[model samples]
Target: MTNKVLNALANNSALLKWIVFLLAAFGFVWSMQLFIAGNAYYSVKNSIEVWQLSPDKASTQKVNSALDKIDNALNYFPNNALFYQIQGQLFEWKAITEANTKNTDSPTTDLTNKVFNLQEAAKSYEKSLKLRPNWSGSWIGLASVKRQQGELDDEFYSYLESANRAGPQDAILHKFIVDFGLQVFSARSFHYVKIKERLKHHLNLGIENPLSRDFVLKTIQKHNANEAVCRWLRDASYPVKKRIPNCITYN
Candidate 1:
């Protein structure tokens, strides 16, 4: 009798069909999520490519369009940490745009808009970190936002440290830390350990990408820290070193 019951259950076509239907539904949901995410990422990628080609063309309309798409993606998949990080970046840039075009007649209104956007950026970064605590970019994003707000507390430095720990050799991470590193070089609360090492790493990448050589040297000079920058690049390859003759000549 037990064998008969087993055979009957094994031959249950209705149960098998329900199982197949459930599997297909799960696959469809998963695929649809990826589709939405891909479109959102494409929107971000396209915006960045355009900005790189024509940064002077940055405008409110372009940013708002990107923000709208990302918001729609978040509505469908609220758990994507990367989406939150991207959202944070968009808000941060929007705030920068507001800052660059402050209205003299309505200075208070401009400041308020800038602060509100920055606060929103910070919240998005915090949400991303909560979802995926170890993402180096999100850490950098939060750190950048805090710096913008001029509220660089212990956590701000900690976030930089976290980003450093997460991706020590990442060229992109090196770029961010070097920029922020120069800003707070003399701050009493600044974390000094490994700071120079990261800057050197960035300069090394600048060496490989010679197009960035001038930017690096210019940034270094602007900070009045070319002396230090020259010292860092003293050991880099010879070809790229020649591009920054001012630094490498005496370096």
Candidate 2:
């Protein structure tokens, strides 16, 4: 009985030791990957910020360098949603840069690059959404890709609606949707009510913030949306009307 008990104890100790070894090995690998991912994340982040601030000045060579780092990081850490999101932005910027450089000399090649990059951006954004379904920014990125693609307006609006639903109180989102709504306000079809109601929601939300209110008012004036602005703010308070000089003046 003593020998049997000792044998069972030995077997259990051996299993525990193997389990600890495997866990330690996994943890070491994971930490190394995290280190790599963190370095790549900051590099990619700076690249994205530069592109957003001044896409015209962002060189293709630098963007390509960022892509290489991102691809390498993704290989090491495939499931990083933020990496995918930034990758999408990089591709989006590359697409526009390529398109802007288009000329008769290489129009076809530029067009091909634009289409391919935009498609890759869309794919990256979609993957990010799959990983993080509730991320409003990715939804907007997807919508932007659809809009720039300039086909299937309904699909664009659908993604936009998803963004709105995902972040009803997101100030940036409100402004973005409002800006786009006014852009095609006169020409929108099928989704007219949907867009208009969302515009109204954002406008109402905009009234709460001085900066947002001023921006919306100025944007409305810029778009020559006097009638719509006045009508939308019909039940507005005196403070609201005071900010919207154009609305009061036009009416």
* lDDT to native, each model: 0.75, 0.77
Clashes (N, CA, C under 3 Å) per candidate: 0, 0
182-219 per-residue lDDT for model 2 (tens digits): 77785665555667888877877776665355556656
Task: Report residue 249 deviation for candidate 2 (angstroms).
Answer: 15
State in Å the error of residue 151, model 1.
3.5
**Best candidate (score: TM-score):** 1
Candidate 1 segments whose C-alpha is farther than 4 A from its true place: 1-11, 49-54, 181-197, 205-231, 239-251
Note the residue pairs that clash in candidate 2.
none
TM value for model 2 = 0.66
